[model samples]
Target: MDLNWVPAADRPDLVAEPVRPALRDDVRVAEIDPALADTAEFCERYGMPLDTSANCVIVAAKRGGEVRYAACMVLATSRADVNGVVRRHLEARKASFAPMDQATSLTGMEYGGITPLGLPAGWPILVDAAVIERSEVVVGSGLRRSKLLLPGKALAELPGAEVLPLAQ
Candidate 1:
């Protein structure tokens, strides 16, 4: 499938140190109208199903006085078990969504465009089991104007990924 992926390396936001090497060979990216960055709108505009787009959410909590971040990828149709499955997985006493500024700064990606492909090491990349069952899925491209389409199984194999029943 010609996903119309331009070189992900071309984007300055994703091409820097510690970021470029993290994107895998199998991942591909494409530009979209910025207005379509949201999953539902993007799906409708692109003729993709809502279920085939995965949302990467950042969840955080403090443990031992250090804040830990986990990237949770769940299908647009479902929601991440943030406080339940995720908090337990991270061993967090309490967990909630990471603030927008923190998420953007830490991942070096736009607010609506973080993906699991190039997240920082040591941060858990939690994948919902259902997402991997698909042959390909759409995810963010590190910018509001683009999206990534890659094999769902490939996402499950990222360095820090843990595939589980992460969606509720």
Candidate 2:
């Protein structure tokens, strides 16, 4: 099957790194016949090394302008304190988790399949610096039940991915 490619223009805020074309070969994409809601189990069953994977979570915040969404990218080994770190980082008067529906709708990726790779341009992507410390990691491939295994360095290179100290 031909890969479902999301063009760069559509993901204005998602930073694409200058990676070797070989990266496409290392990462695999699979379509979930029936979408699964649990991200942890899906990663384990797919032989995804969670220790090196960056888990992406979408948090909603209203910072001066219209309500905006920010993608928090943290390593599987660590967690981003949404209320503490992410909330402050965004400097929103009110911050909360975006409902699965809204998150999925705003981002073209499934709830359990959302990644920082192809998110909406306006959505801010804040990545935990520790994620870049790892040599390799698995990330969502824009679909439920599918994953992308690639070098951690590649993820940090994505545009607008600010490496922050966000592990708790």
Candidate 3:
């Protein structure tokens, strides 16, 4: 829990290429062991609570033969309601987790390190209401070796971000 947090903009190398330009002054970064990047392991190893961590998942939503990608952020202790709320919100006939390769390739981030920040301009970022209620939360830094810390409200303020009851 005693992470050496620093301004994300000051340590661009710690974040993904796409996330660099989007780093807000309030966003902080902390380097960590890549082996423990996954939520459970990272929380356990760092003595952090699961509720203080957020998971960003890439969803592929399709309607009328067009596939639109979106980022959904939820508390580590909650599950994204992909098949219900998300599908309805996106107005997509079908919605499902994006393939790992597609997610990483499109986001220009590592598989386990995709964050809502720096996603493609048109992609919608769905933030769970619970996540926005937290004072601070740990999210991916676009690299498995690091993590980003920021106020929950910061995520709600991101471009194209929509605050909703996205958690199940």
Alpha-carbon local distance difference test for all models: 0.83, 0.67, 0.95
Give the winner by TM-score. Answer: 3
Question: Among all windows of ten consecutive residues in candidate 2, which has the lowest summed lDDT?
Answer: 13-22
The digit string of per-residue lDDT tens for model 3 on 1-168 reads 457889998889899999998898889999998999999999999988999999999999999999999999999999999999999999999999999999999999998899999999999999999999999999999999999999998999999999999988
Error of 2 at 66 (Å): 3.1
Compute the lDDT of residue 33 as modeled in candidate 2: 31
Error of 1 at 101 (Å): 0.3
Per-candidate TM-score against the hidden true structure:
0.89, 0.75, 0.97
Cα lDDT of model 1 by residue, 12-92, tens digit: 453334446767666667778877788998888888889999999999977778789999999999999988999999998
Instruction: Highest lDDT: give the candidate number.
Output: 3
Q: Over the stretch 1-168, how does candidate 2's per-residue lDDT look in tens digits?
A: 222334323332222231122134334444433244255665555555567668889889877776878998888878888888888888887778789999888876666767787677766788888887877766776665445656777667776778888889
Between which residue pairs do clashes occur in model 1? none
Q: Model 2 lDDT vs. the true structure?
A: 0.67
Candidate 3 stretches with Cα past 4 Å from truth are none
